[model samples]
Target chain A: MYVNATLVAQLVVFFILAWFTMKFVWPPIVKALDERATKIAEGLAAAERGKQSLELASKRSAETVREGKEKVVELLVQAEKQSQQIIEEAKAQARIEADKVIAGAKAEIEQEAARAREALRERVADLAIAGAEKILRREVDAKAHADLLAQIKQDL
Target chain B: MATTGHEAAAHVPSAGDYIVHHLGHLNTTGHPQASVVDFSVINLDTLFFSVAMGVIGLLLMWVVARRVTSGVPGRAQAAVEILLEMVAGQARSIIHSEESRKFVAPLALTVFVWVFLMNSMDFLPVDLLPMLWQGATGNEHAYLRVVPTADLNGTLGMSIGVLLLCFWYNIKIKGMGGWVHELFTAPFGNHPALYLPNFLMQMIEFLAKTVSHGMRLFGNMYAGELLFMLIALMGMGFSSMSGVGGSLMWAGHVVAGTFWALFHILIVVLQAFIFMMLTLVYIGQAHEGH
Candidate 1:
């Protein structure tokens, strides 16, 4: 029925519920939304940080590859130079060894030729003295005189 | 009225009589026992309270707008501004239409204030003004219900107003024929066989919404008013009891009442705001045809 009591009672209950909703229910819902927003923000920030680190890592990797290439090039150059020097040293040593062997062989052949010439000279002198003595001693003998005269003429 | 000095006197009206009397409205016939809105006579209290509160709300908003400043505001101005901002924000989120919100937002805010004022009427001592009016008029029968929301007629009237707005927006947003066609063809294909099911579903939804909206407010306020009456009765024992018990009753009455009244203030404002927000949400939904 329509009465003042009913009006008053309804008002009381209505207000109580209104208060409960405003004070209790509304806040948590609002807070839940705010929390979600905050979480999204944090996630975006973390992703940005990860992106930055990735870029830095890529940059370092590129630099390392460049440095390695330079080192490889330098090692190649050094190896080539070392190999050229070894070749030159081996060729020079081989040429000097050939000259020494040729000089020793020529000296040995010249010494043998000198000895042969000296022996031949001594033998020729000794034979010439022996014919002259025989001719002086045997001049008186008949047939030996005639042969010694001929050998002396030929020697003169 | 029991909290007031005169009602503080121990006079315990019987529960049935108390409830009936409290339930009675201030009708033009000036009879406490007369049934207003009955098949016989009409109660003017519901109509009066609704119109009066509605006017008060409009006047308040108008006054606030008239005195609004671009600079720093006084406490009154600031409070009104905050209230306006809150109402507008809520309306914006719920309604999502600048055009409809032009009326709906302010209407929602008005509902909150008006309903809040209606609910706050319960704070008046139950018998204070009614008994005073009776005494002054020399009439043995004078029933007055100050709180408008306590009356089902008043609440139903408000809900009906909301329903009308819903229908209006539905027409404005989705044209008259479009809304009607959608009503028939919706939630199913445009087949003749499914029309009945769709129509029934639509009708049930609308009916359910209107009834529940009205009853939810009615039930809550009605229960609260009954509690005040019960508490009023407890204090009535202060006069009828003996020395020690009477004193104790009086003390308990004071303690319980002060506590309840204080708590009730918060309750009153909250219920109003909820009703207002719901109004906005419902009106917002109406913007979509389906």
Candidate 2:
């Protein structure tokens, strides 16, 4: 219960402990805490930047897909138009070839018909001459008949 | 109490004597103190226990401080960091100057940990250390008090340290002339007629703060230590028992001691916190004008 010199000794000890703590203990711990705070902030900022770039890349990829789809559709339309033109040109060429073959066949048929009519006329003249010889076999004067025959033939 | 060993034929101490002996300090004089306010004597028990506790507490903090990291912390590092941040936050709120807090915050942390460790000595069996001391010294009546904060001298010693810091900060923040002027003139008025009253009030305020700060911790610890002794005496009642009353006394002692020790955990932490807060508050006031 007494106030004694121990108070003074304790006071000196107290100051020594406090001075030691102030010099050694407090600074490094506080520095670590502040540094951790800064690191977390920087990490968060980097994540935000990464997220934005990812969004931009996705948008660019989607735009490329849309362009590719449009080009495919345009190419298909052009191919379809060229195929239709080729089919039309082939049909016109076939029609011209058929008309030329028909004209050549018609000319050959007319020449064959004229030759057949001439052979028929020669055959009629030979038959008529033979019938006249049979009839003149019973006649009296041969020299006189010769002149008549020649004149008849001319008239025929 | 049952007296065993060589003291069986000797006279036994009364309950009052038992408590008085437990309260005695193993000082340089090697005897009980004669006066209530003697500055000439020093208490060796209080000095040894306080410095030892201070050293142990600081050593723990220093180990953690050496390996402290900005990345993920281990259990020991996290525990120390939590304590450090709590003290730093409190100092930040009370003391506005960052430069002052560099010293003041760590000081508060040291006070808190040191005082808490000292107060925790009450949890040991009241006679364990004293009995051990007696055995080792071959003096059956050796005196030893383990808890330093229970002694008024130790508490006042630390409170006076805080007071000195207050005075130093008062002069540093407000120059010597300004602080002296404020002490004599500001509380009432600047007039010469009010000077004496203002100065006296300022002195009284400083004295009151220091005494209460020290007394608060000392009184609580002393009362707790005494209660533990009383409980121990109750347990001792059964050692010499012959009837049912002795059995009841032993049972009561167990229940009361257990309950008190459990509740004392809260008191121990709260008293340390109050002392630290008051120390910071007083020192912070020194940095202000009024």
Candidate 3:
């Protein structure tokens, strides 16, 4: 078998390159890739966390809006109830004052009516006395005339 | 230019002479290999050129490495770094064991660089060195083929080395008894009746793997060498021609040579990368007992 020098030389050179490059170049390269992969994983985790938080925030914001709306509605209902109560109170106060005024007017009217009735009775008695004197002759029994006046007054 | 060379090589020397001379290395002291493998008969030409190119590639990597920064890198570092990253990544994927990968990863890188440096030899002017040597030595018998990848012997030798590694790993990772037992009982039961068939199948598998692994490298190198020869023949034809055909020959040599060289760049890198990946894969397979 013919020996080949070229073949052996090539083998030597190849082994040398393999040794040198593997020692210096390949390790760092492999480490670089590992680093890049780790970074990507971390970035993905962060992004996932960010998305989760964003979702939670959005949900909370929606809940807050709903709560705010509910609060507003409750306040409006309370305002409406308060206004209704105030109106009812105003109406009750007006009714009480009106009842007091009507009672005072009725009492005053009754007292005035009693006084006018007394004055009208007195005038009627005077007219009856005058008419009796005119109808009778000059000297008649005063006691008998008084008795007739009383009867007339009683009959009127 | 190539056409001129084509006519010359087209003469088609007798097959015996052709094979012998083409296979012969232009040695330093008339002996190419050592006594067992002629050390003195060293193909100094190939060694000089191969080492020089290997250094250039290493220097290139080193320069790029020196330039590397944590910030946005330059194109050179980026490209080299990308290649380094790709090779390491592939090595990790193929050879899972960290201890094994320590060696295997470097093995793959060296495979790529050495093979690539060897492959780049095809780009040198085919006659430039040989003609120069003939002029300097006054002897035309100093025929040289520069590219190591173009040498089938070199490729086969490499494959053989890988085969040896595989074998060593297999035996080491799996004890001899385990290996033998697997040979006799695997894919078939441990039953006495199936032993023969199992052993035969197992033997065939080992033989097939070893043979194919070597042959694959041999075949690719052989084809690349043949193509270079053909291209060289074209250049010879152009030189011979003086008139129209001769001029067209020069033009044909140039155009075909340029296109082939450009396209060959892809083949060279691809072939190296493929061989490296396969080496990793085979080594990984060896790590497994079955």
Candidate 4:
């Protein structure tokens, strides 16, 4: 209850304590708080950047996939056209080979018919000469009938 | 003073004498101070407890400061940060100058923690420390008042320290000439006849702020301490009473003691806050014009 020299002593102690706190306690804690706030802000910004990059990558992949699908469709169409052209060329080549074979067969048939007719005419002429020799007496007119036999052969 | 049971009962101090004895402080003179105001005597108990509380409180803060992290804070670190934020917030709102806040904020924090610790001393059982002191010193009539804030000198000592800071800030912010001029011209006018009245009013304002600042904390803590003493006196009455009344006195003692102690918890923290706020306000006023 009394005010004595203790008041003065306490006043001195008070200043000392306040000074000690100012020197040792206050700054570090406040600095930590500020630093923590900065760190949280930076972390949030980084997270946002990561999210944006992820979105961009997804979009790019989707575009590439679409491009790949179109390329596949184009290749399929080109292959189908090439296959149709190859089938048409093969049909034309087959038709030409068939016509050549038919013409060669017709030529062979004509040659064979001519050879057979010649053999028949020669045989007929020989038979007529034998008959004439039997009908007339032996050696008469052989030279005179030569021209007629030749003409008959030519006609056949 | 060592005596058998019968002699001990006879030697026991009366209720009034017991309270008066507890009120006595351990001072330089080795006796209760007789004078109402004496500059020569020092209350060693008040100084010792106040310094002890100050040292302990600051050491805790220092330890937390040493290990503080910008990352997730430990519980102790978080608690200290909360207290610092509250003090710093008040300081920021009241004191406009960033440069001045460097010192003033810490000063407010120191005042809050130190006063709160000193006020918490009231929670100790009234006779606990004194009895221990008597046992250690082997003095049957040893004096020890634990709550430093209960002593007018201790509270006034701190309030006066705040006053000195106010003076420093006034001079620092408003230069010596400007402060002196304001001291005379403020809350009145620039007129020459108003100077004397303005000066008088300024002095009274200073005096009133300082006294009320110190007296508020002192009065609350002192009254709380006295009420504890009175509650303890009821226990003495219980011992001296017979069957029914004795039991009733005992119940009253326990009930009153518990209720008062619980209520005093609020007062203890509130008084600390008021002291800190007033400190910021007064220093802030010093930064402003009249």
Model number with the top lDDT: 4
Q: Tell me the spans in candidate 3 whose CA falls farther than 4 Å from its real position.
A: A1-9, A110-156, B1-37, B56-98, B128-145, B151-157, B175-230, B255-267, B288-290
DockQ each: 0.03, 0.62, 0.20, 0.75
- Which lDDT values do the candidates have, in the order given? 0.69, 0.88, 0.70, 0.91
Residue A17 miss distance in model 3 (angstroms): 2.0
> Which interface RMSD values do the candidates have, in the order shown?
11.4, 1.0, 3.7, 0.7
Highest-scoring model, TM-score: 4
List, residue by residue over A87-138, the lDDT tens digit for candidate 4. 9899998888888898888888888877887888788777666666777758
Residue range A1-156, candidate 2, lDDT tens digits: 877899999999999999989988888888888888899999999999999999999999999999999999999998899899898889888888887888778877777776676565545544555665667665435477667655654555
The CAPRI-style docking tier of model 1 reads: incorrect
Task: List candidate 2 segments past 4 Å from native.
Answer: A85-156, B1-9
Every model's TM-score: 0.61, 0.85, 0.68, 0.89
Q: In candidate 4, what are the lDDT values of residues B207-232, reduced to their tens digit?
A: 99999999999999999999998898
- Give a tens-digit lDDT track for model 3, residues B149-178: 555446655776777778777787788887
Residues forming the 10-long window of minimal summed lDDT in candidate 4 chain B? B1-10
TM-score of chain A of 3: 0.65
Here, model 4's chain A TM-score works out at 0.68
